[model samples]
Target chain A: MSCLGERLTALVDGELGHEERDRALAHLAGCARCRAEADELRQIKGRLRGLSRLPASDGADDLPTDDFLTRLRSLAEPAAPAAPDDASGTRPAHPGTLGGQSTRPMRQPVRGAGPGRPRDNRPAGRAVASAGSGALRRHQRRYLVVGAATLFLGLGAASYAAGGRQEAPAVTPAFDRFAVEHALTSGDTPMTDPLTDPVNQIQTSPGP
Target chain B: MTRYTGTGRARRRALVAGGLAGALAFAGTVTGDAGPARGVRSDPGAVGLLRAAADAARRVPYEGRRFLTTWNRGRSATAEVAVTHRPGEGVRYRASSGAEGYRPDSAADESAGIVAATLGLLARNYSVSRVADARACGRAAHVVEARRPGGGTAGRFWIDSETGLMLYRELIDATGRRVVATGFTEIDLDVPAAGPRITLRPAPPARGADRPDPDMVDAQAAALAPWGERLDGARLARLRSEGWPIPKDLPGRLTLYDARSDGATVHLSYSDGLAAVSVFVQRGSLDEARLPGWQKTVRRGRTVYRREALRRWAISSGNGYVSTVLTDVPQSTAEAVALDLPRGGVPFWTRLARGARRLGSAANPFG
Candidate 1:
């Protein structure tokens, strides 16, 4: 069972069959990442539904109050309206669903925001980034110390390997003994094999 | 009336001719009748020359430039050596020392070890014959080829006419290819004698004269081991009785003549009188480190390392006992001897030695 990216949204919208809904729910319960995304979508859907209600009192719970303010601001502000379906009393379409799979999901508005609008995401984005940077700053020295030691060891090893190449270790065939042995067997005098390298050039006198 | 004397002399001459013809017929008949009694042997002329060549090789004194050529596995190599010799004493060889070729200055113990072999041993399986005559080392030499009884030539010898010494020798394979050939290129006849032009070159130093040959050492080590106590053959038999599976023969006519164990290595020497092969077995797997330039082969469902080194072909394999066969014979013989060697039932000390060697190598920091 691979991830059903759009099917999970379909299940939440009561668009899946009984069997498919049960399987998607079971998968969501087992996978924390899918479960978290599903939970976020549920919250967004509940807030949108709350906006369709008549009104909420001052002592009401956070959802109704948050939904009222968000809807009122979108209407009263000098910005484009998010969706025509929202005013026409039809359910807003869903934009995206859970990820990690290819899908042609239902196109819809997200958080009453219009499609392809240039929104200022920097103000909220900077807040999360500052908190992440503070935590990372605490361990910066440890990462540097470990990286320096690794680099030093690697350089030392490389030099040591390069130094071994000046004199290549080669296996030299012993010839003097072989020549002598062949001579002994052949019935000539047995100095048949030669020595290695410069020693092989050493001249010798004839037998007495 | 005067012509009677002349006619009588002519009749007497005719009688003498008839008597000579009758005697020749009688001799021919007697020789033909006695022919079967002498018994026939194949290639007598070549066989006799080979024996004479062996004698002359040991007794003659000469200085020459000799060339040795070796062929194996479709590859061949030749080396030229300047040689000086004193019969019954020793032989000295000097070669060019350069990267252009491989040659060495060496002194051989010219004893009756392996070279001066007689035809009597080879005659067991080969028929010696004077197949042809050839010129070598600026002298006329008779070509004596040793042909197998069934077919094919095993070896050839070119003996000089004047000195009876072998001017050239070739070891032939079963496929009619020459495996080894060594002969002088140029020769000088008079040396080591009391004469005006008999000046001999001085011998090389004796600093390292007795360098050990690994092949011969292994063979001698096995031959000299004492085994039998009462039965006079029980030392190895005792091991055999202890459930060892050492074999007595290989695929061909090769027979195991000597077997010994020096705690680690089991040495066995096989010979068919003409060819000698040595098998060395030690408890361990094949050493991959020692096999850099060696060729790898798979035979009889086992991996083998084969190479022609130092004029001898060797094939090695190992599982419990690392068996290596070294011989101047063909590579097939070496491989056959190695593959047919007895396996398993390796002694405890051998295993221990193998383990210790590995541990030692592992402990070496430099490696």
Candidate 2:
């Protein structure tokens, strides 16, 4: 590639302005190879632009057909009549298989059995749905039990925390005796209590 | 000068004997000397000053209004009292408010010479030193301070240097905060003519008995009704012989001179010459509900309740033997004595009640 090789891409993309564009044009006019490359790039850009202008549905292969839409609409509505069963009355020798080919047994309500008892003729899908619902109910019951237990535990803790604290014993003081005793042990002379002498003398308990 | 000595059985015997001597002294059956039953010697200086004060309170013809300030919780209460002394007769105190609330105190310390054993105890417990000369009640006063060995002044006294009478006194705590201050606000030295002789009538005896109020005995009996037995000198001697856990001296210089018990609760009277502490111990629980304004603090895993009333520090505490220590000393001394009481295997229930009382006190929003 020559020095003009890089300029060929810039010229085709119109990234060169004014003087750069004129220089690239003059180089392309002088270089036959660069002019051929620029012409090819121009044709590719024109084709890409024309393609971008086309409608979105130009390729119909990415869309759903009329038959597919009819099928989806029928499925979206309420349950319709069950698909027709095999017309042959003979049971296959392999039980669920006819000549090594597996056959799907259509679900048909049991006529001789209970009124609402449906025959288990389909695949194991119905059994899976039944087991799933049962397990869900059990989980719900478990959640309820767990919630009730948590509520009880929380209440008990709060009650214990809010209850009263322990207290100690009370001993009252004899102010009269204290002051008197204080005076006594202190060097202060005994100030006679006019009210207590007779009672003191009277209450002198006899020695046992 | 050592007030208490000896160890073990001998010590117990000596304490019992001393208690008997104290009992005799309390019963007015003996003079000042209770013999060497308790290993305490009388201090002449303190004894003489106290005797002089007592004599002056009675014999000196003087009239003055005394003001006493007492601390309650963090507040102070004052008593404005007018005192009239007439020789050869009783001292009369009249309140300024004239509420007819004049009640003469009879529980004076009746030591040999002094009216109170207080000064003697003070001299025994504290080292007394003369500070300086001051004035009190408009008279020349000699200042004396009663200092504890560890540090801090327990009490200060301003005495009339000429008359030897106590004119002012102040009781202070470890933090040097005044608990009680009593002094004459004004004085009239001139003696008035002897007014008509006023006779004071005695109030009726308590409990309708010919005898009067039984202070701790009743309170103890009410608390310890089941395993209670009243202990006198003889039983105390017997208990000493049997080896009980009674202490001869408490945490401070407080010497236990007399001990009485009603089966469950034991009342031990301790004196350090000046300050007197009475400790009541019982086997039952303390109803902390009865105590208000009492603080709860824990020391060495034991709960203590401290409160001030009636010019004394009252502390209630116990693990098994609920001990309420009431004293004229500082709160620290009272709390120490309460925690150091005899701790035996008290029931879990007692501690529960103690804890409950502490909790109740803590929960109470008001003092």
- Summarize candidate 2's per-residue lDDT along B1-367 as a digit string, tens digits: 1444444667899889999998977766344233222433334674466557666654456677767665645777555656666554434555433322222233222332332444555655666777778898778987877776666787888888777767888877777888767777787767663766345442321221332334433211111010113356677665544324456677656676656543344566777655567776544446567555567888788778776543444454443345567654556678788777655432344444444555556678993
- Give lDDT: candidate 2, residue B179: 77
Superposing every Cα of model 1 onto the true structure, what RMSD results? 28.9
Candidate with best DockQ: 2
* TM-score to true structure, per model: 0.45, 0.44
**Candidate 1 structure lDDT:** 0.51
At residue A130, candidate 1 shows an lDDT of: 33
| Candidate 2 residue-wise lDDT at B275 | 57
Query: All predictions: root-mean-square deviation over Cα?
Result: 28.9, 26.8
lDDT of 1 at B299: 74
lDDT by residue for model 1 (A1-208), tens: 1365645556656655566678778998899878887887677767755653434533234333433433343344335344343222222122122221112221123333443211322232222233255424433654688899898667555444433221212222222322232233333222233322121233122111
DockQ of 1: 0.03
List per-prediction Cα lDDT, in the order shown.
0.51, 0.51
